[model samples]
Target chain A: MEIEDENNFKLRPMKCELNYLSRSDGSAILAQGETVVLVSVNGPLDIKSTSQSIEKATLEVLFCTKGGKPSVADRFKENIIRQTCETAILGCLYPRTGISLTIQELEDFGGLLTCTVNCACLALLNSGIAMRHMVAAVCCAVSEEGNLVLEPSYTQVQSASALLYFVFDSRERNLVTGFTEGSFSENTYEEALARCRLASDVVFDFYRDIVKQYSDVI
Target chain B: MKISIGDVVLPGDYCEEISQVAEKSKVIIGPGLRKEVDRVYITKPGVLKKRNPGTFWVDSYQKRYVPSRGENVIGVVVQKAGDIFRVEIGGSITAALSYLSFEGATKKNRPEVQVGDVVYAKMLVASKDMEPELVCVDSHGKKGRLGVLSDGFVFKCSLNLIRKILNPNCPLLETLKNEWPFEVAAGMNGRIWIKANSMRETIAVGNAILGAEYLNDEEIRSMCNNIAAILAGHVS
Candidate 1:
């Protein structure tokens, strides 16, 4: 699946960053082009729980705007990120206590969900919240002329009929989370998935570059 | 044979006296009955020995005071022992203000003074006792700028910047001439007190004060919002 320029839609600028704060265990700011989101992770810290503290860690998520109000779309995005992050995080080691994560978006040009999840992954690493592997997200827009575009921007996404966001953990090349079309045929969905896997490689490479740049400072 | 304060004598200047009048020299060199002493001694050639004498001078590391018959000095009240309050005049030694010194104060009020309050007063007397003593009074039987500033915000910055801001022709200074109504007390020690202004105006002045150091126009634009935000108290 290819998202073409003739469709008047293009790939969004993937503006992402990691380990942006020192006070938190993990923190990152991901700006998917114009969409800027700040994500922070607070540890598997000590929590008073009776008896059942030995088995699995808990996950807690909070979402808010600059003024602390949760919009409907923000709530939807928060739930998606929470579910996706829970899948990627190592939930067994931190028993009894729930690790908390907060996502705040200052500016949203487009592709907010993808950027929020990507930033959450980096924030988990920054918080030193243990994770099975690093993960990344990219939104792909399928153009009318049968071209698959990776990381579609706000304008491109609006112009396109269908937009799909793929969240993947690079270690196992596993799909941790996914969002896509309902009306398209199975063939097109499969093609978009294939393109998504390829698009994920680009995000993974970007993730590795970020880690390499910040490894020395860490 | 007698030494006084601010006396200039040479190094080995007392050497001859050390032999002939050892007692008097001992009084000068050793701790004597004097409450305090200030002497400038330079090294000179010894009479019996052959040695070269070089000429070099250095001021003492101890505190130096500059007071005319009437010059105002600001001091911070640091201690209260018995009837006296010890005021630190930006130096190692403190000046004492006795209860009697507050003559103008009525008994009902009793001129309440406390530690950490900055007081401005004229030095009626500066003499050595156990330490330097200062009386807060004027000869015409009147109180001058001899009161305590007990409440306000205090911050420290370079003294040079303060002087620059106080300069009337300074562009940054001109911009803030009456923009913010604030009484600023700039100290030689770099402590500045900016009191009672709208938070917005105070921050604007602070930013403009900082802008004096940065001469670039474009560079300042990037910081303009931040400066405004700081004045707005949006950014802590």
Candidate 2:
């Protein structure tokens, strides 16, 4: 299960564009390989008395698939995204309000959940929403040969033995959320976590570059 | 990129100049600039703008409309509840427009307003705790360009674009006004109501305004001329 070669792990080509939608407060379209996700955020808006919390803003996440209705799996994805984003956002700053995030899946090659999380984070940043710290997620798969593959494509995903998604916060690189799909040995899981955490640096650097590119426009 | 004035700033970034000015006198920090115990920090991702001596604010390209007092907004009449009309100004909550807020209206006579109509009104009271209030008449009881808009096309754009086109220095309106006869009412809420002699002209005006959002002053002028020439059948 020990693959010491660094070349074994590589992320797919990533692209992101902010403010993709005119109606949403903040929006972004993110693509990794063939997987594309569009995310829009609207909030710090008025909340109904029943849903409004006096102490913090209410967070809602919705996931929509391509030309299909949302299913139970989509609901689970939305729940994971909402919980991860809630930890990053400074919800207390917008008390008695609501922050709604809607994610639309345009394409799903592989690692769809990871791409969704990353896209949502960028959309949140574009919205100018206050946050305690930024979050970045990376997905890794363990192939049949025990090779760790970062951001495996659709075909690779089908052949992989196990898959893991890890989300890290910017403050201390702490784990915000982690999801696993298949069983793996303890040593293999630890190795995959370490590799994915290292690969997350690439995502974080990508975020900074995107922000800096837009910051120059003004 | 430049890290100076007119550059995009993010939350938690501090400005030494603002902090220094705060020491000399009481400075009014507008939206996007927050004053903590130590320094002045930016709370939005946009260009930092300064006016004259002490007024500072961020010129961010935002789509959401946050209601503020004394600002004119174009809203739709969504609900006609008994005495108050709930107007959707793209804010968190619908604003209340009382029928009596219209000019020459009394208990016996109610303003002829219906749902789905667009109204150009002024925000009388916009607070965080309560719903906003709108009025179609001025203090002198005059409907001075503030009333229900009729037979015009309404569309929404980014809030910053509305402000950009409305700015006196902007050449978009100046150049377009000469090409054709058109009337435009731009609301601070990112909604614009435009009307022209023909539907083609109206669409042309709309396209020009929307296209001018990303262009500079010189580019905007040229774009206006291009649009005008096309509308005049100079280009196919």
Candidate 3:
């Protein structure tokens, strides 16, 4: 469908809970539509001498799918999530340390990457880790009719000709990471970027509300 | 989006009020707030707070302990190397506690510190680049409330709860102290060491502190009262 205005383009329903886990320093479970990802943050913890750095904290992201060992696809997801979060984290504050994020996929209705990235950011915020800024991810799919679907479902993504995911920082709304699947034209990519960027504000507002809810009394 | 004091804030949010004060004279940007080139951005999510005379900070919740200098902390002695003892202070790195830093300790005289001994100490040097150091004695060579802690129960809580209970206005500790005889040493590292006459009382102290995490001042007082009633109204 053609989305003309900012308000016309909509995101999937999102549900989130902060600090959901007991043991981790900070944890969150975010559900975007039917997809749900639980993320827990643990860090500025000690690191082995071999992997330790003198300038900043080492970040490790572990992405696990439901009821299976991690695979190559999971590793790729880990790399993207790690890179997206590493840019926002202020690692120099605690040098010679490490931060580890464990992301668990509870459900996958659609738009898993977007949901996972957003959930990871929320978990980081709940952990109160010093960050330069926060990031929000959005996904858009180009259907066979050459129309865009914002935050499409699993069936929509399966039937789509092209899929695009973009993560934007909260400060400038600049793109932090972008992942593309299948083939799309230059104009189609530009349109997807614009639409996804507009949809990211919803993700950011969701983050603000969740943080306020947990830190309200404190 | 209301960038005002007592209002919730998020990363990348800037307060014009802080800059207005900074333009006039000087404003101290505390933790969770960073002064960039043009605007002062927030790095943490919480309520924005401004102290009198020009101080700005974000009151946020944190569970992990980031060591700061001159804060009291409870640490467990992990290893006793020749001149220094490694104490895990819940930070990324284990802190170094010199044997000579203890009261009456010298080259020939060493404090009887063993492995896995909990101690109340102050952060001597907590630089991010260097190893954190701890001391059990003050400048006056007195071990005032800073030494090996024995016969007590130690538990970990959120850093926010620790600060809340330690705040002068918080009623959790005030009401609990009046209800029972207990001694508490709260560490900035999110650890609370409590010593009471009985194990039940010690557990009660821990429970009261944990339960007060989400309660306001009035609720904290009532919770303390309720705990007292339960502990006292029941059999020994």
For candidate 1, write residues B99-165 as lDDT tens digits: 5566475545466887787766656554322344555566554665455655655554433345445
lDDT of 2 by residue, B31-67 (tens): 7777777767666666788876888887665777878
User: How do the residues A119-209 of candidate 3 rate in per-residue lDDT, one tens digit apiece?
Assistant: 9999999998999889999999999998888999999999999999999999889999998999989999998999888888888888887
DockQ of each: 0.01, 0.27, 0.79
Error of 1 at B76 (Å): 36
Which pairs of residues have clashing backbones in candidate 2? none
**Alpha carbon deviation, residue A128, candidate 3 (Å):** 0.8
Candidate number that wins on TM-score, 1 or 3: 3
* DockQ: the better of candidates 1 and 2: 2
Clashes of each: 14, 0, 0
In TM-score terms, candidate 1 sits at: 0.44
lDDT by residue (tens digit), candidate 3, B113-166:
999999999998989999999999999999988999988999999999888888
> What's the TM-score of every candidate structure?
0.44, 0.80, 0.97
Model 1 chain A poorest 10 in a row by lDDT? A1-10
lDDT against true structure, model 1? 0.56
Checking candidate 3 for backbone clashes, the offending pairs are: none
TM-score of chain B of 3: 0.95
Q: Give me the candidate number with maximum DockQ.
A: 3
lDDT score of residue A169 within candidate 1: 72
For candidate 2, give the docking quality class from DockQ.
Answer: acceptable
